[model samples]
Target: MAAVGSPAIVEASFISRLVTRKTVMIGLLILVVVAVLAILAPWIAPYSPSRLSVVNRLKPPGGTYWFGTDEFGRDVFSRTIYAGRLSLLVGASVVAFAAVFGVTLGLVAGFFRRLDTPIARIIDAMMAFPDILLAIALVAALGPSLVTVIVALGIVYTPRLARIVRASTLVIRELPYVEAARALGVPTWRIMSRHVLRNLLSPILVQGTFIFAYAMLAEAGLSFLGLGVSPEIPTWGTMIAAGRQYIGQADWMTLFPGIAIILSVLSLQMVGDGFRDLLDPRLRKDL
Candidate 1:
C-alpha cells in the first residue's frame, strides 16, 4: 500500500469502497442493463410491440413467444422492453421539470425572507395531501395524457424538492461565504446561482434519484388505474391492467411486466441509498 493519505491510496480506497458496496454495484448493473434495453428497444425488440395475432393470443411462455403473448397476441417480451421507454421518459421528464421549478422556488424561499412565508405556506398546503391522491387529482383535472401525466407528477413532486432545497439554502445563506458575497453586493441571482446553488447540488442530486424512482412508480400507478397513457400504449402498468382479467389463464402477461417494474424501481431505490451514503459527510465518514 502507498503511504497513508497519498493520492494513489485515496483513489484506490475510493474504488475499493465502491466495489464493496454490493447494493450500489448490483443496482448500477441492473439499472445500466435496463437502460440499455430501453434505449435499444427499437432495434432489440424481436417483434412489433403493437402487432396483433388473434390465433396466437394468450399463448403461454414457450419456444416461439419467449415471455408469452398478451390478450391481443402482442408479444409480451417486446411490449415489456418498449414499455421501459415511457417509464424512463416520464421519470426523466419529471426530474427535469421538478428540478427546474423546484430549485427556483427553493432558492428564492430560502434566500429571500420576504417571499419565504408565502412560498413555505404554499408548499405546506400542497404537502398536506397524500402524494398519490394529489397526483390523481391533478391528472384528473388536467385530462389524462402523456403530457398531462408528466406535468401532474412534476407539480406534485416539486414541493418535496423545493422543501429540501429551502432547508439547505436557509442554512447555506447564513454561511460566511454567502454572507460575504452579499456584503460585497453580489447580484441576488448571481449569489443564489453561484454560491448557494453549487453547494446545494449534492442534496439535489440525491433527491433527484429518489424522485426519478417515484415518478416511475407514480406513472405506473396512474396507468394501472386507466388514467395514465392510453391503453394502446404498451406501458408496463397498462400491460398488467390489460392482463388482470386473464390472470389465471395467462399469468405470464402480468408476471413479466410486474417483474420489470419491480426491478426498475428497486434498482433506483438502491442507487439512491448508495448516493445518500456517499454524498452525506456523516455517512461518508462512517464508510
Candidate 2:
C-alpha cells in the first residue's frame, strides 16, 4: 500500500514548487519586502505616526520627511509604513480565520454529497449580497474595532473560499485512489484531511493570497468610513480620509497613502497570479 504523505511534506512540496516559478519568485520578493517593512516599521520609521508638528503641517515630500507631513503635521512616510503593520494584520487574520471555517465545511460538504446541497445553498445566499456589502453590514451591526473587522471580513469571504475548497474536494474524492481507500474501509477523516486536503493546498494557497489582499483593502474601506480601527491608530484608510480634507491644499497628503494601498494590493495580486501559474496545471500550460 502506498504511504499517505504527511501535511508538512505536502506543504513543503507546494512551497518548493511555488518557488520554482520565476514569476512566483518575484511575487515572493515583493511579499518579503512588504513584510519586512511592516515588521520593522517601529524602528525604521523616522517619526512617530501620531507625533504632531503644527508648524510643519502639510509640508511636501523632501529631505527629513520623505512623504511629507499630514494636515496634523504627522510624518506621512512614518505613518504609511506604520499603517502597513495593521494592514498586514487585518489581511493575515481575516484569511486565517476564514480558512479554518471555510476549508472544514467545504471538505465535509464535498465528501458527503447529502450535505452539499444545503451547505451550497447557504453559501450562495451569503454570496448573493456582495462581499464588501456583507462586511459593511456586519461591521455596522457589530460596531467598529479590530476584532469586529477581522471577524466581519472573515464571514464575508468564507463562502467563496468554501466554494473553491469544495470544488477541489469534489474532484479529488472521485479519483481512483480515493475510491480504493473507501473500498478498503479507511477512516473517512484520514482520507479527507491527509489525502484530499493536501492535494488542494495549491489552490488554497493561491486563493489565500487574493483573500489577504482583498481583506486589507476591505479593512481600509471600513476605516475610511470610520467603521474600522480607531482613528487614533494610524492606518492607510484613515490616512486617506484625513488627507481628503487637505487634498486641495496639499495633494501629497492623499496621494501618498493612495499609492501605499495600490502597491500593497498590486503586490498581493501579482503573488496570487504567480502561484496560479505554478500550481494549476492548466494555467501552467498557458504560461
Candidate 3:
C-alpha cells in the first residue's frame, strides 16, 4: 500500500470518496451513459432520427417503437438519443466561449486598476438583462441557427464567469506569492497566467458545470420558441415543440425528450455540486 500522500494513495482515496458519495456516483453514471449513447447514436439508434413512416404516426410506445412515433411518424427514441449530440455540443461550446472571454476580461479588470472600472461596468451591464431575454435579442439580430444560438448563449453567460473570476482575481493578486512575483519583475502575463489563472481554476471549473447545464436548457428553450436551429433538425426542444400539438394523443413524443433533458441537466448539477465540495478547501477535509 502506498503512503497517505503518495500518488497511488491519493488516487485510491479519490475513488473511495467518489464511490461513497451516492449522488455524485449516480450523476456520474447517468452522465457517462448519456454521453456514451450520444456518441454511439448513429449505430445505437434503431432508425434514422428523420426517417418518416406515415403508417406509424402517433403510435404509442411498444416493442416495435420503444418511445413511440411522433406526429411526423419519426422515431422518438432515435431522435431523443441523437438530440443529445447537439445538446452536449451546445453546452460545451458555450462553456468554452464563456470561459475564454470571461477569464480574459476578469484578469484584466482585477489586475489593472485603470481597466477595472470599465470592464466591471461592461460585465454588470451585460448581466443586467435577463439571460433568456438577452439571448433572444441576440438570436433575433444574428438570425436563428445553431451557431447563432451558441454565440447568443455564450455572450449572455460570459458575464457570470467574468464576475466570479474578477472577484477571485482581486483577492489572489494581492496574495504574498503574487506580490513576490511582482517584486521579482516577473512578466505581467506570466504572473497572471501562472499564478492568478491557476488559483482561479477551482471556481472556473465549478461554474463551468453549471454553465453547461444552463446552456443545454437554454438551447432547449430557444428551440422550443422556434428561435433556435431549424425544425428539421432533431433536437429535444424541437421534438417537444412538435409534440405539443398532439399532447393528448402522442404524449410520448414530448415525454422521452423532456426526460432526457431533465436527466442530463440534473446529472450535471449533481456533478457540479460534487466538484464544488471536492475542490473547496473548507469542504475537502470532510470528503
For 97-165, candidate 1 gives per-residue lDDT tens digits of 999999999999999999999999999999999988999999999898999999999998999999999
Candidate 3 lDDT, 1-287, residue by residue in tens: 67779978867877787778889989999999999999999999999998999999999999988999997788899999999999999999999999999999999999999999999999999999999999999999999999999999999999999999999999999999999999999999999999999999889999999999999999999999999998888899999998999998888888999999999999999999998898787998887
Candidate 2, position 35, lDDT: 78
Candidate achieving the largest TM-score: 3
Ranking by TM-score: 3, 1, 2
RMSD of each: 2.5, 3.2, 1.7
lDDT for 46 (candidate 1): 86
- Quote model 1's TM-score: 0.94
TM-scores for all candidates: the values are: 0.94, 0.92, 0.95
Q: In angstroms, how far off is 283's CA in candidate 1?
A: 1.3
Error of 1 at 225 (Å): 0.7
Judged by whole-model lDDT over C-alpha atoms, candidate 2 comes out at 0.89
Instruction: Tell me the deviation in Å of residue 216 in model 2.
Output: 0.9
lDDT of 2 by residue, 169-258 (tens): 999999999999999999999999888999988889889999999999999999999999889998989999998888888888889888
Candidate 3: residue pairs that collide:
none
